[model samples]
Structure formats: structure tokens, C-alpha cells
Target: MVSVGDDAPDFTAPLADGDVGSFTLSEHLEEAPIVLAFFPAAFTGTCTTEMCTFRDQMANFEDVGATVYGISIDTPFTLNEFREQNELNFGLLSDTNREVIDAYDISMDFADLGVRNVAKRAVFVVDGSGTVTYTWVSDDPGVEPDYDEVAEAADAASE
Candidate 1:
């Protein structure tokens, strides 16, 4: 996993931004800090709750000049539906190929559940300089990150 103070891995992926736009990590870092929330899948209970938490606290993140994005192995089409259904204001990035997932070393195999290469529940805060300022990887997929800590990291990165 990428640690704090390490340069965030750069990647561009299709974003479920209403119109199928793309998000480049480095490009976004040039503008503001970024909060990347990697989840296993869309429409799952835990994923839904975690994303909604981010949505509800978006203002706090925005106040710190940070952009929030949820990354998953799901396709953009499915993610767009999920975003609309949940009224998510942030972007849901499609890491369908699992390239970014692998790069971040957050992939999980669930052979017993018949799933593979899904992302572990994780959060990463990247500053304007593309350095990872914060990271949280949940051992259980059902667990969520600390929202307050994430917000504080974003606030600190903005300064």
C-alpha cells in the first residue's frame, strides 16, 4: 500500500461523471488535494453507507480545497446508476481493469465468495503536490474510515 509522504501513483480512468468523463490523478493534484476512497463494489450495503458518509460530509472536504472520488472495479455505467440512486455529488471512478487497484496494492481475492481482484475498503488523501498524506486500509470490507481524520488530513494538506 502507498504510505504517507510517498508520491501518489498517477493514473487516468473513466469517471462516472454523468457524461462518462475521465479523471487523471496527476491532473487533479495540480488543482487541489484529492480523497480517493476505494471500495469493493457498488450497491453493497457497506459501500453505500461509506459513500453516503462522504457525500454528506462533502462540504467539509470542499472547504479544504479537496476533491473526493470513490474508486471501484465496477464499470462506469453501473457506477453512474449507483451515484444517481444515492445522490452522490462526487465522482465515482471506474477502475474496471483493476490496473489502479493493483498499483495501489489494495486488491482482494474472495474465491469462497467467487469474487476476485476487487479493491479492499481503503482511503487515501493526496495533496496538491501528489504526495499521499493519509491512508487507511480496512481489514474488513464492512469497516469504514474515520471521516473526521480524513477531513483533518485534507485540511492540513491544503495549508
Candidate 2:
């Protein structure tokens, strides 16, 4: 996991949110806290649970003035289907090229373990200044993050 105060690599990736057309990261970076919830893949067990949890708690996060983003290595087509099926209310960014993951140094070349070139499941809380204030990467995908803790971290950092 990245330490607090590290600069989150600035990169623009394709995003599709509901009917919203494809856009870049800059479109959503202003005026609110950005929570990049990086999951391993779309439609997987832990990933689904984690994303749905974020979807459920989105309003609460917005009430506190935070914006959450769901990012994964899934193709845009898979991401679109997952978002529509789950009724996700946030931008699902496609890092299919793994550029963002590589830039952030979160990419794992786990070919030895039979899974290759997938990013680790992680959450990065980036402030308006684009500095990382909080980061949590699940060593094992089964262990989802405690949403409340992430919210608290965002709340505390925004103050």
C-alpha cells in the first residue's frame, strides 16, 4: 500500500457512468474528495460486495461531500454490464491498459500464482490537491474494507 502524503499519479482514463458518456478523471476531480476504490475485477464475489457496499453508502458519502469512483481492469463492456446490473451510481473507470495501476505502482505480476497482470485490490483516498491521504490494499480479496473506516478517514482528512 502507498503511504500517506504520496502524490497520486495523475492520469485520465475512460469512464462510463450509467448513460453518461465516456470521460476522463479530470471531469470528476474538482470540488469533492475522490475515493478511488480499486478492485481486482468486475462481477467477482468480493468485488461485487465491495462495489455494492459503496453503491449503498454513496448518498451518505455525498452528504459528507465525498465522491467515490469504482475502478478495475475489466474491459469497458464488462464494466458497463456490471454497472447496469448492479445499478451502480458512480463512475466505473476502465483501466484496461493498466496504465493507472502501473503509475500508482499497485500492479501485481502474480503469474507465479497463476494470476497475471491484475492490480491488487486497493482504495486510495485522494484529496483535492491530488495527494493520497489514506490507502488500503487487500492482501486477500476475501477481506473487504470496512466502509465506515474509509469514510472516517476521508472525513478526518478533509477537515
lDDT, model 1:
0.93
Candidate 2 has a TM-score of 0.90
lDDT of 1 by residue, 1-159 (tens): 889999999999999978699988988876568899999999999999999999999999989888999999999999999999999999999999999999899999878999999999999999888999999998799899999999998899889
lDDT of 2: 0.81
What's each prediction's TM-score? 0.97, 0.90
Residue 133 shift from truth in candidate 1, angstroms: 0.5
lDDT of 2 by residue, 35-128 (tens): 8898888998989999999999987678768889888888877888999999898888888899888877777755667876677888888887
Off by over 4 Å in 1: none
* Model 1, residue pairs in steric clash: none
